[model samples]
Target: MNRRMMMLALLAWACTAAPAVSAASPPVDDAATAQALAQAETRGREMFEHDLAAERATDALLKKRMRGDSRVRGWITEPKDNRYEVSMIGEGAVVLYRATTDARGILAGATEALAVPAAPTAYQAGAAAARTLAMQSRIDACAKRYNSVVLPAPGATTDAWTVYLLPATTDPAAVPLGGSYRFDIAEGRITSQRAFTRSCIQLKRAPRNAAMIVTHMLDPTPTEVHVFWSLWARSPLYVTTGEDVIWKIEDGRIHRVQD
Candidate 1:
């Protein structure tokens, strides 16, 4: 009774306890997980903002050039060593790549143009893959706070996404302003960001720039394309009044045209 019963009892306990011991998890490193997430968020936001600034700077150059004979047909971007190479194409075989700062530095002087292969597909692929990073807690925090939408940036081929923020208020009399950030998907960092309060205020006050886009614009176009949004604003005198704002894109550069 004693020896056999004891052995049987020990065997039963071992079988039941072995499974539980094997399934037990090691101590969770909450700190490490949190830190990794934070870093990802930081990188995502940083890249997005950086790309936005670079696009703006390029737009300035394009609008100026467009006024002349150098009508840009299309363009793309390539990320070099800590820099961005923007290749603007004119008519046929009229390609020129200019290396510029990574959206952080000032767009002061122009770098000499270099011959580079056109690679829009590569950039787009990178952007598509990196988009999953948007779910990271840190990047999500920024999006929630800014009321932003994340998508591929219009114009250029820098493998980046745009985080566009909506205006605080849509009142015509008060003003309509917003902000946007450009993120480099491959690097998972913000390239640049800019606030457009003044432009919004001006557009809001003006009856001409009344019609605005209620819903944000997602895909502008396949190639160099432009988007429009009907600006809607309210005034004490009138109900809802406004005009439309044209977001023009040429070779990855965005410029606003308002009536």
Candidate 2:
């Protein structure tokens, strides 16, 4: 109630409050925080490139074949330096392939090389089934390939993950197949995968040509990539040579390929 008592009470409050306020205050080194962010970005880019190189090597090795009927082609695009496009050609024709990469380049995934069927022999019906099975096998192979690349990375950040998803082939004769993949970074592993089929059909009228296209779009932080495919055309009256393939990519390695 006295003046001295009031001053003492106020002093006690100020001392207690000061420590609490200081403890609650955030750090004030703006420059240091900015430097840390820059370092993370730089490190992310370097890791992305390293991963990309390894992916390219894996693709090149897989492209080599025993019968010489299959071929693989690929290229990388700019800015982030982690995006890529890849394709597989079979029997001088485009079969099936995928294109993908990430900001950190630690994850690169691709589809399996779809095999082109040899001309139907005297056993036409049986040969057609065999060829269809072969194409399906290739799709399965691609799924496995993607799985192998992505499953190795774990704790991968958004910038560290890469994905490649192949929609079911619209061509019934090609065995109607589709699948998808996702990769991790921290552990350098694959996070998930999926595959499916719709129906079965004959390939008597199926075309013999196949081709793939991959585009890498990287800039302004997040990167983008695109994939396209061309397949032989077939019809009742007359057979067309091939159909144009079109698709798009976003944020590093997200792809939208046509079915």
Candidate 3:
């Protein structure tokens, strides 16, 4: 069957499933609710694992087909409800496809792969950044590099607030990937981070003057606020400026900035 058919089937099945009673029932006390949550988590894990495996398989297949093609790096997989988005990279082209899987972990519904322009350098940089940011040990490095701006709110005393700033490549030549990022710090130790891509940017045809805008909270002291701006560059041809702000504290957080 085609991927569209498989997706339709999955949608139909999900629709037919019986809905649970008591929409507000807590999972801890409700058996059915607990089971549903567990199942969802399990499915998420399984989907990620399967995606990894599929990427490896696709990589090997591409290597064989290309015959020692150094430009052919690998594949990345994104899983959906009943289908997967797979992108295979090569020297000058990329093959993108939507693949459906069967219960036995076999590829079932398959679509004709679409060839698109490739951006090897940009892809490598993005993949590297992703891997590095995903590691636990890198949290501190990331935090230190992109620390939160703390400032006081106007007309408020004894109340200070801090907001985290996300790290990004400031390279003008690099493609811009939109996302909101936050870091969790406890007792001076970085705990976790919440990061996601809001939209994907095309690297192959990225504009020459591409730039990213990042904003963070300032200190909660009316005296003075220090703003730090850091940028990473893929080339040495770009120029940028850092903006400064002064603010006051209100309600335990920075409320206003002196414009």
Tens digits of per-residue lDDT for model 2 on 159-185? 233333333344444421223222222
Query: What local distance difference test score does each model get?
Result: 0.37, 0.30, 0.33
How well does candidate 3 match the true structure in TM-score terms?
0.28
User: Per-candidate TM vs. native?
Assistant: 0.30, 0.20, 0.28
| Residue 57, model 2: Cα distance from true site in angstroms | 16
Sum up the clashes in candidate 2.
21
Looking at model 1, how many pairs of residues clash? Answer: 37
The candidate, 1 or 2, that scores higher on TM-score is 1
Over 1-259, each residue of candidate 3 has an lDDT whose tens digit, in order, gives: 7754464344334323422111222225467645543443343234334434454446445544444546543444434565444455543335433344432345554433445544444333343233233333433233223312211122324222212333444454443322324443332344555443333221221133322222222211111111111111221111111234222122112222222
lDDT of 3 at 247: 24
In lDDT terms, which candidate is top? 1
